[model samples]
Target: MDRNLAIEFVRATEAAAMASARLMGRGDERAAMAESILAMRSMIDSIECRAKVIIGEKGLFDGVSLEEGIEVGRGEGPELEIALNPLEGARVCSTGGYNALSLLAIAEKGSIFRPPAVYMDKIGVGPDARDVVDIRETPKENLTRLAEIKKCRVRDLTCVILNRPRHVNLIREVREAGARITLISDGDVAGAISTCMPDSGIDIIFGEGGAAEGVMAAAAIKCMGGGFQGIFRPKNKAEEKLLLARDIAPERVFDTEDLVDGDIVFAATGVTNGSFLNGVLFKPWGAVTHSIVMRSQSGTLRHIKAEHHFDRKPRY
Candidate 1:
């Protein structure tokens, strides 16, 4: 993929973020998601590339989506695979909560893992401790080993988990192991990404989240050379059927490299403020946006603060 596509991708995320920012606190996630998808699709369709959304967040917005395996872009440039989460945390965004984002990942054709959207049991950590943590080990054992590698006590470790009822035993084990927990309502991708960012103060992540989110998070981790491992968890017979129909193995552990292969580019624009990136800010002149774009081949990450003047620039 050409390096210039990184900036083009950010433009889509930025447009999605700006489009959804107005719907914050409106308690209408569907509307917010629809606006973001439409805005992003408009931008993506204009970009000069032949792309397929092999992995995407679908089923929201009354069947609106970038959609898995659906064609996007201008159909005139590089062949690419796109993984997208137009509004990562719509529930959080609707409630005016933390860590809402519009983000996507790109790779050459056949590089990204294609999975049916299902729950995935996962473990994530930074580059320093990436080699130490193991998904096959018990949570307490993993935490103990991670603490040893970090040269810190078990109590000093903080793990992120989704606040779901299914995590009851997992949460108990982490607490019993003497590690603190950060429970997030949604947006585990950001939570998982935090583990890879040293200043983020997040040591590791453990629990189940969306499979699409796992791939998106894994792409960022792969770019940073961090650690992430996941296995599919189908909740019901229908879900199991959907996964099995695609020839996906539930028992296989998907590491960062397995999730995203070859060189990759990822872009994100914050819709609401949280740990790493600031949310879009509306002003009299226009709006200010905070975004970041990264590439694995060159290991370059760029933080952009863009001021959009509506009078001069038009919104799609």
Candidate 2:
């Protein structure tokens, strides 16, 4: 992939965020997601890559969906594999909550993992504690190890996890282990990536999330020199069969290399204010956006803040 495409990818995320930010607090998640997808797809169509969506809107059974293997872009640049979530947190956007964003990861063909939509057990940490935390370990044990690596007390460590019913035991154990917890509504990609930032105040990310998101988060973690590991937790026989047919062992742990390899590019634009980036701010004549673009080859991270004037340019 061309290094210049990093900024071009940010444009796609920015378009999605700008298009859906207007629907904030509307209490319509589906509409917000639909609008975001339309905006993201529109922007991607003009790019010069032969991109194929490995992870997208829906599954194979959906009548109308952007499932795996769908080709995108204008077919004039390098062939790429794309994993995207146009609206990372639809519920967060609809309710005007925090940590909602549009995100995507791109890599050379055959470099990105193509896992079926399934729950994955994931554990992520920053470079400081990367070698200490493990997904196969108990939550309490992992936190204790992380605190030791950071030279901090167990109580000083803050763990982030999704606030869901399935996490009741995980939360209880973390609390029992004497570590602080930051429970978020959605967007584990942001939660996982937060650990890599110096002042994000997130020491570690633990618990289950979408398999596709696991791959996307791994891409970012790899670029940040962090550590991430995921194990597939298939819910049914169909999912198990899919994994078996692909020769993916359900019990195997997938590290960053197993998820995404070679030079990779990741870009995200915030739709609602949160830890890592700010939400879009609409002005009288236009809107402002905050985005982050990173590349693995050069280990470069760029924070982009741009303003769009409606009067100066036509809306897509």
Candidate 1 backbone collisions, by pair: none
Worst 10 residues of 1 by lDDT: 56-65
Q: Which ranges of candidate 2 are over 4 A from the true structure?
A: 59-65
The alpha-carbon lDDT assigned to residue 1 of candidate 2 equals 74
Cα lDDT, model 1, residue 17: 95
Q: Count the backbone clashes (under 3 Å) in each candidate.
A: 0, 0
Model 2 C-alpha lDDT per residue in residues 102-146, reported as the tens digit of each score: 999999999998886489999999988878888889998998899
Location of the lowest summed lDDT over 10 successive residues in candidate 2 = 58-67
Cα lDDT tens digits for candidate 1, 1-316:
8999999999999999999988998999988899899889889999999999988756646455688878999999999999998899999999999999999999999999976657789999998888999898999999999989999999999999999999999999999999999999999999988897778889999999888899999998877778999988888999889877988787878898888999999999999997889998999888999998999998888989999999998753
Number of the top-ranking candidate, with TM-score as the measure: 2
Per-residue lDDT, model 2, residue 249, is: 77
List the candidates' TM-scores in order. 0.95, 0.96
